[model samples]
Target: MTMKISIERLGPRRMATLAVATLALFNAGCMVGPDYHRPQVRVPATYSELPGWTQAEPNASAPKGNWWTAFNDPLIDELEPLVVVSNQTVRADYANYQEALAEVRAAHASLFPTIGATGSATRERAGSGSVSSAGTLVNSAAARVVNSGSLEGNVSWAPDLWGQVRRTVEENAATAQSSEATLANATLSEQVALATAIIELRTTDANIDLLEKTVDAYQHYLDVVTEQDRAGTIAPSDVITARSQLNTAKSDLIALGVARAQYAHAIAVLVGKNPEELEVAHSAAMPALPSVPVGVPSTLLERRPDIAAAERKMAAQNAAIGVAVSAYYPEISLSGAAGFTQSPLSGLLKIANYVWSLGGSASETLFDGGLRSADVDAAKAAYDATVANYRGTVLGAFQNVEDDLSGLRILAEQADVLDAAVRDADRGAEIAFNEYQAGTVDYTTVATAQATQLSTRQTALNVQESRLLHAASLFGDLGGGWSTDELHDPRHPAAPAAAAAGSVQGGATSAGSGEEKVQ
Candidate 1:
C-alpha cells in the first residue's frame, strides 16, 4: 500500500477567491502620505501702477478659452491648433507624460498577484551500464516520455502598510500631471512664437512697401534735378546730391527686403517648414493690435501653464518625502503558487497529483549605516527646495504679467504720439513737393522731405508691430487662457489665489481712457 499525500494546498478556485479578497483589503483606505495643500504666498490685491490708464472695475469675466482667438486673426486661430499636435517640443513633453503614466501603471500593477502558465515535455533512455536493476547484457533500453503542464499564480504585495506604494503612486502621478502641464506650456509657447513671428513678418513687408515707394519718389526727384542741371538751372553739385539721395533710398529699400526675408524664414520655421518652402505672400497690410482685457489678479494662478507645471512638481516632491519616510517601516508581501504534476501524462489531470504553495513574507532593512535616514533627510530637503522653487515661479509669473502690461500700455501711448509724428511728416513732405513743383524749393529740399516722411512712417509701422508683439507677450504671460480648473487636479494643491491677485496688482497700473479700440 502507498501513502498518498495531497501537496496542493490551494485549489484554483481558492486561489482566485484569495486574490479578490486581498485586492479588496489592499484598496480599502485613503492613500497614505501628506495630501498636498497650497502654502500661502503674498500677493497684492490690485496693481499699483494704473499710471495714465483710467482705472476701471475689475472684470470678473473668465479668460476666453482660446485667448489668441480674441485677437480675431483668422490665421492665428487656424495655426495654433496645429502647434499643440505637431510641434516638436510639445510632442517631446507629451511623450514624457506618457512615460510617467506608464510608471504609475507599473506601480499599480505591483499591488496584485502575478499569474503564469508553464509546460514541459521530456524523453529519457537508460544506458546499459547505468541500469543496475536491468539485465547486465541489455544493449537496448526502453524509452519513456514524460509530459507536464501546470497553471500557477504568485502574489507579492508590499502592503502600503507604511504607504510606500501610495507615496510612490502619488509622486508618479504628480510627475505625470507636471508633464501634462509642461506640454500645455510648450504648445502655448509655440503658438505665441508663431503668432509673433507672423506679425513681425507682416510688419517687414509693410516697411518694404513703404521704402520702395519712397525710393521711387527719390528717383523721380533725381531725374528732375538732372534735367534742371542740363538746362543750367541747377548746379552739377545739386544734381550729384539728388542722385546720391536717390541711391541711398534705393539701398534702404534693398536692406528692408533682407529683413523681410529673415522674418519670413523665422515664420517658416515656426510653422514647421523650411524657409525655401514657405510662401507667406501677405502683402495686404500690417495687422492691428488686439484689445486685451485684464481680468482679476487672482486669475493668473489658473491661466499660466508654467505656474501649473511648477506647482505640480511641488506636489510630486511633497509625495517623495512620504516615500522616503516609508522606508522606515516593514514591508509585507504575500506569495502563492499552485499547479499540477504527475509522472504519467494521464495523471497530470488528477487532483491527487496537484501541487501548490502559499506563503507570506515580512522584511525591514535592519542596518544600512544610516543611509536610509540620510535619504529621508535628502527627500525632505528636496521637498523644501521644490516649495521655494514653486514660490519663485509664482513670483516670476506675476512679474512677467506686470512687465508686459506696462509695456503694452506704454507702447499704446507711444503709438499715439508716433501717429501724430507721421501726420506732421506727411504734411511737411506734401508742402515741400508743392514748393519744388512751383520752382521755389530745390530738389534737395524735396529729397529731404521724402526721406523724413518715409522714415517717420516706417517708424510708426515698427511701433505698431512692437505693440502687437507686446500684446502677444501679455497674452502669453496671462496663461494663454488656460483656466484654474485645468491647473488644479484634485490630487494636488488648490489654486494660488494670492499669486493671481499679485499679478493683477502688478499689471493694473494703466487703464483704458474709455474703452479705446486697440486697432
Candidate 2:
C-alpha cells in the first residue's frame, strides 16, 4: 500500500517554515558599506561685522517659525503662501521629490518575491492507430477528444547579498531629500523676491509722485519767468533756463514709470498670471525696515535648505559608491513555480497531477576587461567631487549672509545723510523762489535751486528703497529659519537634516548642535 500527500496538507506548514527561513536569512545579511559621515570645515568664532548692532540678552529666545511676520507688512505676509502653490520652479522640485520617493519604494520592493497567478484551458484530438490481438492480425482504429485546464503560479525574489538593493534604496532616498529641500529653498526665494518687488514698486510710485509735484512747481516758476520776459523785466536767457529746468523735471518723472511697470510685471509672474492679467493698486507704501535676528553662523546649516540639500547630495553620491562596489560581487536570485493540471476540467483540482519547481541562480563578472574597476573608480571620484561642492556651498552661504548684513548697515547710514541733504535742498529752493517772486533774485537762481531739490529728493527715495531691498536679502540669506524637521521624518524621504549623521565631524560639538535650528 502506498500513501499519498496532498499540497493542501503541507502548503501552510511549508509556507510558514519558508517565511521564518527567509526572515532569518535577511536578518543575517550584512550591510557591506561604510556608513556616511558628514565632513566638517572650520567655522569662525564670531562674525566680524556684528560689533555695532545691539546684541540681544544672553540666552534670549527669538520666536520660532514665521519670522517674516516680524516686519508687520500684511501684504508680504499674505504673499508668502502663494509661493508654494504658484512658483513653477518650486512645483517642479516637489514633483522630483515625489518621483524619488517612488524610486525608493521600487527599490525596497525588490526584497520581496513577485508572485503571479495564471489559468488556461485547451482542447485536443488524438488520431486512431492499428493494433494486433490474439493469434489473428486485427486493425483497431479509434478517435478520442480531450480537454485540459490548469491553475498555476510563479514567484521570484532576489536576495540582497552585497547590500546592492539597500544601497540603491539609500541613494534614492537621499536624492528625494535633496529635492525636497530644493523645493523649500525655491519657495523661500520666491517669497523674498515677491516681497522685494512689491516694496520696490511702492517706492517707485512714491518717487513718481514726488517728481510730478516737482514738475508742477517748476511749471509755476516757468510761468512767472515768462510773464516777466513779456513785461520786459527778465532777459530771454532766464526764460530759456526756466523752460530747460521744467523739461528736466518732466523727464525724470516719466522715467520712473518704467521701473514701476517692470515691478508690476514681476508681481504678475509670482502669482502665476500673465503680466496683463494682474494689476496692483500701488496704495501700500513701504513700511519701516524689518529687523532680522541674525542667528549664529553654525545655525545657518540648520536653516538653509540649499546647504541641507548639498549635504544630502553628498550622501546620495556616497551611496552610489556602494552600489558600484556591489557590482564586483555575485548576484543571487530565487524562483519557484507551482500548478495543477488534468486532461479534464473535473480533475484539474486533484493532487495526482500536481506540479511544482524551485530554483536559484547566480551571476558574476569573471572578466570585463577593466570595466567594473572603472565603474568603482568613477563612483569614488563622483563622491569626491560632491564633497568639494558641499564645502563650496557652505562657504557661499556664509558669504551671502555677511554681504547682506553689511549692505543693510551701510545703506541705513547713507539713507540718514541723504534725508538731511534733501531737507537742505528743499529749504534752499524755497528761499530762491521767494527771492525770485520779490524781484530780488534772477530766474536762473530759482531754476538751479529747483533742480537741486528734485535731484536730492530722488536720491533719498532711491536710498530708502535700497535699504528695504537689502533687508529682504538678509532675511533670505538666513533662510528665515524655515523648518525642515518634517522632511527628516523616516516616513518622509525629504527630512532636511537626514544627512547630518547626528553630529559634525571629529565629534566636535557646537553651540546649537542639538537644537532644532534651520537657516
Candidate 3:
C-alpha cells in the first residue's frame, strides 16, 4: 500500500496578490547615490560697466517678436523671422533637440514593463523506421504526419530597485533641456549675424554714395583745370593731377561693391536663399543705433541661452552620477509568460493544451575587477568638468556684455570728435576752391583741401558704421532678448514636455531655494 500526497497550485487571484507584494517591496527600496543640487556660482551684484546705465522700463506694448526689431529697420524685421524657419544651422539644432526629447521619452518608458506576443506553426513527417526512446521501432508503412502550433504572450520588467531608471530619465530630461537651449542659441546667433550683415551692407551703400559725390567733384575740378590749361592760365600738369584724383575716387567707389556684394550674399544664406537669388536694394539711410536695455549682471545667466545650455548640461551630468552609482546594486527583473500549444489543430483550444509561467531573476556583478568603481569615478569626473564649463560660460557671458558696452561708449566719443573734424575739413575745402576760382591760389591747394575733406568724411562714415555694428554686437551679447523661460514653453514647439517640466522645477527653485541662483 502506497501513501498519496497532494499539493494545491495558486489561483489567478493569489498570483496577482504575490505580484503586487513583490512590486511594493521593489518600490520601497531606497535609491542609490546623491540627489542633484546645482553647484554654487558667484555673480556680481551690479555690472561694473553699467555705472551710468539705467534699465529701460519694461514695454508691455512692444512687439513681442524678434529682438532685432529694436534696431527699427523694417528690412531686419522682415528678415529676422526667416532665421527660425529657414536657417540651416538653426534647423539642425532644432532636429537635435527633437532627438534629445525622444531619448527622454525612451528613458521614461524603461520605468514600466514591456509586453510582447509570438506565434508559430510547424508540419512534420515521422521517418518510416524511426526508433522510440524505449527501443521500439516504427514500421516503414506506418509513418505518420504531425502538425504543431503554439501561441505565447510575455512580459518583462526591470524595476527601478535602486532608482537607476529614475536617474536615467532625469539625465535625459536635463539633456533635452540643454538641447532646447542650444537651439535657441543657434537661432539667436543666426539672427544677430544677419542683422550685422545688413548693417554693414547699408553702411557700404552710404560709403558708395559718399565716394560717388567725391568722384563727381573731382571730375568738375578736372574740367575746370582743362579749361584753364586751354586758356594757358594753368599748367597741363594741373589737369593731370585733377584727372588722377578723379580716377582714384572712382576706383575707391568700385571697391566698395565687393564688400556690399559679400554682405548681401551672407544675408541670403542666412535667410535660406542662394547668393545670386537675393538682393538688397541700395539705401543711403543708415539705421540709427537703438538704445539697448542692459539689465543687472545677475540676469545674464538666465538671459543668455549658451549659459543656460551649459547649466542644463551640468545638471544632466549630475544625474548621470546617480545612474553610475546604481550599477553597484543588483538588477532585479520580473518576467511572466502565458501560452497555448497542441500537436494537432483540432485540440489547440482545449484547456489541457494551455501553459503559463511567472518568475523573477536577480543579477549582481560579484567580481567585476573594479570596473563598476572605475565607472563611478569617471562619472564624477565628468560631472566636475561640466561644473567647470558652466562656471566658465557664466564668466564669459559677463565679459561679452562688458566688452560691447566699453566699445560702444568709446565709439560714441570718437564720433563726436570726428564730426567736428569733418566740419573743419569741409570749410577748408570750400575756401580753397573759391581761392582757386578767383586765381588767388594754385589748383594744387584746392586738390589737397578736397582730398583732406574726402578722407575726413569717409572716416566719419566709418565711425557711424562702427557704432551700428557695435550696437548689434551688444544686442547679441545681451542675449537677443531671450529669457530662460522660453526654453520650457509648449507653445514653442521645439521644446519637449520633459524639458518643460524640468524648467518648471528650475524656475521654482531659482529665487528662494538657496541653491545657486542662475538669475
Ten contiguous residues with the weakest lDDT in model 2: 510-519
Against the true structure, what is each candidate's TM-score? 0.84, 0.87, 0.87
lDDT of each: 0.70, 0.75, 0.80
RMSD of 2: 9.2
Q: Once model 3 is optimally superposed onto the true structure by TM-score, how far is the C-alpha of residue 251 displaced, in angstroms?
A: 0.5
lDDT of 2 by residue, 1-519 (tens): 975434355675797686568756863586666679998976665556787544432324443446567667666666555566666666666667657767777876776678899899988876565556655434334666778899999988888877888888888888877877887788778878887887888788888788779888878888988998999987899889988888987888888878888988887677555676656665535657777778567777777888888989999889998888888888888788889988877788887988988787989889999998899889889998999998899899889988888888888888889888989999999999899888898877887788788889878888888878877877788876675573553334444234233211222212122222110
lDDT of 2 at 299: 72
Model 1: per-residue Cα lDDT over 154-201, one tens digit each = 445555566677678778878777776786788778888988977877
Give per-residue lDDT, candidate 1, residue 382: 86
**Backbone collisions counted per model:** 10, 9, 0
Give the lDDT of residue 297 in candidate 1. 62
After superposition, the stretches of candidate 3 with alpha carbons farther than 4 Å from their true spots are 1-29, 52-64, 126-144, 489-519
Q: How much is 453 displaced in model 2, in angstroms?
A: 1.6
Clashing pairs in 1: 46-505, 47-505, 49-509, 50-509, 50-510, 51-509, 53-511, 54-511, 297-500, 298-500
Which residue pairs of candidate 2 clash? 302-518, 302-519, 303-518, 303-519, 304-519, 479-519, 487-494, 487-495, 488-495
Worst 10 residues of 3 by lDDT: 510-519
Whole-model lDDT for model 2 versus the true structure? 0.75
